[model samples]
Target chain A: MDKNKSINQSANKNESQSENQSRYIGVNEWKRHGFQALWALVTNSYLLGFIQGKIYKGRLKNLCVPGLNCYSCPGAVGACPIGAIQAVVGSWNFKIAFYAAGFLVFIGALMGRFVCGFLCPFGLIQDLLHKIPFPKKLQTFRGDKALRKLKYMILAVFVILLPMFVVDILGQGAPYFCKFICPAGTLEGGLPLVLLNKSMRGAIGWLYAWKNAVLLATIFLSILIYRPFCKYICPLGAVYSVFNPISVFRYRVDKESCVDCGVCAKVCKMQVNPVEHANHPECIRCGACKKACPVNAIR
Target chain B: MSRVFRSRRIGILLMAAGLILMGFGIHRGEMAVVFGKAVNICMECIGIG
Candidate 1:
């Protein structure tokens, strides 16, 4: 870590351009490439299951990656959370999946936005796009603490409750977040499937139009905000926050050497306090804040 | 950390191996989607080709 700080001393690592230009290896580089790689997965058949469907669609097979990936994505090789939840709810299925719950807890405990920062291909796309040169507004760090609470409520209500308790006697479950929300699904999942299969495209109507509008709005809004969906929405981030305190790999702060000098906070993409939630769940482990600290107070 | 990397090496290799096996399973008499069809919709759809 010291060696890295020394090398980047003359070079500001915080700039998205510098980071892009710098030859960073390890997990983070994989993230930049992984976002593209999933697209490669769509092209090549390397990890088709993540884009297509999983090996088994059994009762207990839903414990998996959190963010929305299209189960119908031609190259997908795993089960998507929204799809799994829908499958579970549709079947009016067994006990709440202990494995699924545990997986979410485990991810939250580990890197908070590590999933967002690295693992999630969709989140990576937004991060890459945000790097595109443009002036944008950062959220109100001081004034909007209350509204920031909306994400958690969204996690609870839209992501969890509606799917779990709102099942009808007909035993049908809705992909609440995907059907009604989830811009990732709208853009990545829904549109592609429609375009690829003409039948699905021809059948499109009010629902498709509505989702497209949300997708267009989100894409437009993404240019104005760093990550509009990720900042105020994305229930997965809320769930991951639950495990922030004890996550396996997370930020730690050194208070003694520290001035409460807020360089770290200002550059923070997620607007989380590196001092407060050192391993903050909202933090996507983007490394932006760590690189921002002038005194190297954070690690 | 070296130990961590060593273990990760094994784990990644294992994952690679499994993905390879899965690739093999998915590869019976299949022709690659000629890059032409893939490239056309690559950027807007999946963000890469």
Candidate 2:
């Protein structure tokens, strides 16, 4: 009788412990989502632009937001960092994008990829898409490590190199990443403006079709995987990731408290082993590992 | 220096550098350049033109 009573108590304790852990994770997720939504709304607050089908042309547009928000987004009051960089680099007069580069350095030093985790509108979209209750969600796959490096290449070739070297007759270069890639631009800027403006509808051609295809692929892939764009394609994410290790706000694993249970690794959507790589460039600092750590080791 | 203090120092230095760079850019009228690009609808960004 005593044995059975003890067994029941132990079972109850285990259940309560799991409930507590899940509650902690839930709170963190809510906080992150709230912050992301607030930032998105704050940055893209020009509601009249959406209704009137015009881009915001306020003085605030000179400032670059930390995430991959499109400057051409109908409601965006601030410019995108990547877009701003490409613009200055591609200009006939400027070889260096000092303003945009400064903004990136400031944000990266302050929070690293924490912007990706808790500020980016597109990141919030991916998080929502990933929560659609799909079966067989893939956390990692073949060539995942190799594929992760693709974002850096895109940053180098499309955002920086092509925009710097490739020029038109007037000696001005094109925003290659914005023109050829960037699903955010398509979803936020292209579709809305085209839908609202009949003239823009007539202007739609092969390029718009190509961008739509890319956007479709991103949307579907986001449903299957966690942040496929951030992990594989986003140049902004690539830039911020470089600062993750030394950023002011970063993860630190407490050696004395960690027990090697591997729970944090299992819960991490980014596939980062926080115990081994506390501030891994891949880690978005989403707080999943910290919340999942049984001994409260990660901070 | 300890790891935390070292990380904080680096972050502060980077922040200062970024501020200085931004100030220089502003002095050079790069803000106006950025404004010129951002105020207009970027056809390239929308994958048009």
lDDT of 1 by residue, A38-92 (tens): 6435432424333432222332222245554544454444455544434443335
- What C-alpha lDDT do the candidate models reach, one value each? 0.55, 0.89
Q: Which segments of model 1 are wrong by more than 4 Å? A: A1-63, A141-143, B1-49
- In terms of TM-score, how similar is model 1 to the real structure? 0.67
For every model in order, what is the number of clashing pairs? 15, 0
Residue A268 alpha-carbon offset, candidate 1, angstroms: 0.6
Fnat by candidate, in order? 0.00, 0.72
Per-residue lDDT for A74 in model 2? 92
Q: Global CA lDDT of candidate 1, please?
A: 0.55
